[model samples]
Target: MTEPQVRRVRLEEGFEVQAYIYGEGDETLFLANGGPGLPSLYLREPHARLARDGWRVVAWDQLGCGASDRPQDPALWALERYVAEAEQVRAALDLGPVHLLGHSWGTWLFTEYCLTHPEQVKSCILADGACDIPHLVGELDRLRSALGAETLAMMRRHEAEGSIDHPEYQAAITILNYRHVCRLQAWPDSLTAALADWNMGPYGEMQGPNEFTYTGNMKDWNRIPAMGAIAAPCLVLCGAHDELTPACSEKMHAALPNSWLKIFEASSHMPFHEEPEAYFPAVRAFLEEVAARAAVGGLTRKSHPCR
Candidate 1:
């Protein structure tokens, strides 16, 4: 299979965003990362597979992460701003009515974007994401408790004081990230490399001192009520062992009018990496069916409150 070509596009404010495009096909798939500020490089592998399957896949770093411009201003980290950025990216690439696949935090932004711009999306796939911030926090709490009181206390002390830069805090965060986030004892090279280049500037400012804490702008953010507004056919995926929990994903699936849920039995948060054999085939099949339906003028979306 041909390797993806890395490219750049200039947005409205002259901000340059980097994107990797692979394959040549009528169907365009945009992969959005979760960090709100995370770079899109972590999505490269999945996009590559999607491209190899006859779909054009575009994955880009968001404004504050990876190869994108990282402005020190915290205002650049808002949810709506990311939504606008996704829209601009789509328009810049001339990818109208595209299929959107959002992972983790990216799923939140994509859901908001889809709710606001239903007409611009043909389909959506939310992988290991949550519809409620409280639900996410609860999951974190459960994981912390499972780690035992002593570990939980240590994590709390650091997270409370914003001392995530401390080595102990880093160790704790690593444990949590590995356990529920990726489930791999050691993060994959692609993920590790991406993490190494992570612009913690924005993450510290927005996502709090670490992943468990939620003093950020997205703390109380819950899009559960807005799920019904999403008109596109959606595939909600969750890892059976994901920290986001299958319960949260199922809630989203139940609320969405045209949605389905799939649980990768042996995977954790990153199903694409953990269970690529199963994840790729499932995604490819869904996208193909969606494309076929659209070709027959069968996939139609309805306008809802958020739109």
Candidate 2:
């Protein structure tokens, strides 16, 4: 792959974040990766391949992670602030009518952005994410409970005591992660890099201690009631065992008026990483269909991929 051109875009007067631009095409794909605190590396590196197909791919580090400025202000970690940050990034980059893709936490951000600024988006991709936090918390409880009463009790006990760093607790989390997060025996370098530099400040404030926990400011956040108003054609993708859960994707798909859903049977949270052969093609097809529709000034039509 060609080296991505890195650009620093100012979000405010003095605060700037890094954005990686790939290819030079008429159509653009703006990516919002998972992790309230992760750099855009994991999503950028893999999605950059879309550049080869004549699509400009743009991924950025949000305010508190990656190459972005990380201030100590706790108030800046809110979802509303992040949504505004996304708009600033789009405006700074001059990405016109982008095909927006949000993975995990990015999906929550993506749904909110589209709700707030529908005119700027050509289409939406919600991958391995949920828009309903309360429902997601319940789903998470279900997933963790599958570890049985003994393990679940231990996890709860540790969580109650604020001992998540304990080895046993972490070991349970690892097992759940293996089953529902990546499902890959070995993770890709890009993913590992993002994990290594993860800024837990924003994560703890917005999401919580780990992927399975939801004791953050956003734990009660839900956009399901507002999803129907999003007019952009949407593509919802999830792995059968995603931590976000396929049920979450289904709920999103059902709520979205113009949308389609796909469940990757052999993958988990990072289907793009776990099943790229299937993942990339699905994303490309949806974007292509949307672009074609825009080109002809036709109404957005649903492009269904095999379930």
Candidate 3:
């Protein structure tokens, strides 16, 4: 694999973030990783491999994670601020109307950015992402419910007592993670590293303590109503056993005016890691379709949405 070239890009309030660039091509695929708080490492490494296929791939650490400057101001963690910051990063790098890929929390940010700044987006890929937080929370609850009445009760007790770090509670979460988060008996090193160094400030404030809970500011957020207005060619990718769930992807797919949906049957949240042979090709095909469409003038809402 080729090494990515890293650079420091300055954001508002003088905050600087680390950006990585792979390959060199006219068309760019910009990445917005999940975890409002995770570094770009996990998403960057795998997708960076896509650069070999003749497209520039760019990814960055958000304001307070990875090698980015971590300011202690709580005010900087808002979605609106992050959206503006994403725009700044694109503008500074001079990547024109990139193919945007948002995983996990990044899907929320990129979806909003796509809506607000349509001209700056060529296409969008929402990987293991959902636009309805309330619905997503419900899906999470359903997944947890499979642990049976006894385990659920213990989890609830720990949650109520703010002992989520307790062994029993963590053990329960571990099972669900193995089943829905990645499904691989052993997680990729890049993913493990990203989680190891994860910054939980924005995560806790915006998305709660863990993947299965929704006590954050965005718990009630729902963007489905506005999804129909998104004009960019979009691809919605999710695993059957994803923590975000296929139902969430289906909902987003139903609302997006110009989009395609792909569900990896035997995988989970991190399908790119769990089923890369299938995942990468799906993504590559989508990018190829977008590029081909762009070549014939430009894409339009009238264009047939793939599935």
Candidate 4:
């Protein structure tokens, strides 16, 4: 893979966002992380291979996450702000009609951006994303049951009492998050470091005490109706064992007019990390198909063509 060149751009609001760019391919791909607070560093390994395979991969830390300027005002961290940040990054990089990919919470921002500016997107990939928080809450409840009442009760009690700082509470939350989020036996160093640097202040104030609970503004949010309005070709990916589940993503695919669904058999929430071989190929194939269609329709430059 080529050496990654990191660039920092100042948004109109004076917030500096960092982006790591790799490769010189014509196809520019933007990857958005979940956590709303999770840095883009954890996505490095997954995207590095994409860069090696002839795609210009750009991963940026969203505001209040990673290396970006984390503002104190909670209002500045909303999904609308994030969508604007994404647009700013795209414009700053001059990456027009780019392929957009979002994981988990990032999918919310990506979906909103696509709906609001479909013309700017060439294609979209939503991986392990929860389109509706209510639906996600139901799925979390099912997983909680399988985890047994005792553990669930303990988790609830700790969260209710605002004891997230307690080591035991942290441990319990970590276990549950790992299982449903990444499904890795142990958290990888890159991911762990990113998590360590996460702006918990923002996460707590916005997303509540834990991942399962929804006390934030997005609690009752549902984008099912907006799915039909998306004009770009979309690929909705889910792992067989993902907490988001194939059924959830398939429902999104059904609602989208121009979309496809793919499930990775041996993966969970983080398919790019859990099943790189399948995940990368699937993404490349989808982008290629979109590029081919665009080429046929004379929508893009032939000189700087996509593979």
Writing each residue's lDDT as its tens digit, candidate 2 over 80-106 gives: 989999999999888877889999999
Question: lDDT tens digits, residues 1-307, model 4?
Answer: 3468888989988889888898889988888987878898877656777887788999898878777888888777678878888999999998887899998887888999999778888888898987877887888777766677887787778878987678876777676677767876876777778878888666666566667777877788899888999878788889888878677797788888778788989888888878888888788878777776776762222222221
Per-model TM-score versus the true fold = 0.92, 0.97, 0.97, 0.91
Q: Point out where model 1 deviates above 4 Å.
A: 297-307
Clashes of each: 2, 0, 0, 0
Q: In model 3, which regions exceed 4 Å deviation?
A: 297-306
Angstrom error at residue 238, model 4: 1.2
TM-score of candidate 3 on Cα atoms, chains taken together: 0.97
Off by over 4 Å in 4: 165-171, 297-307
Which one wins by lDDT: 1 or 4?
1
lDDT of 1 by residue, 51-162 (tens): 7678888888888788877678877778887788889888888887899999988888899999989999999999999889888888778877887889889888876786
> Model 3, range 205-236, lDDT digits (tens) per residue?
88899999988888999999999998888889
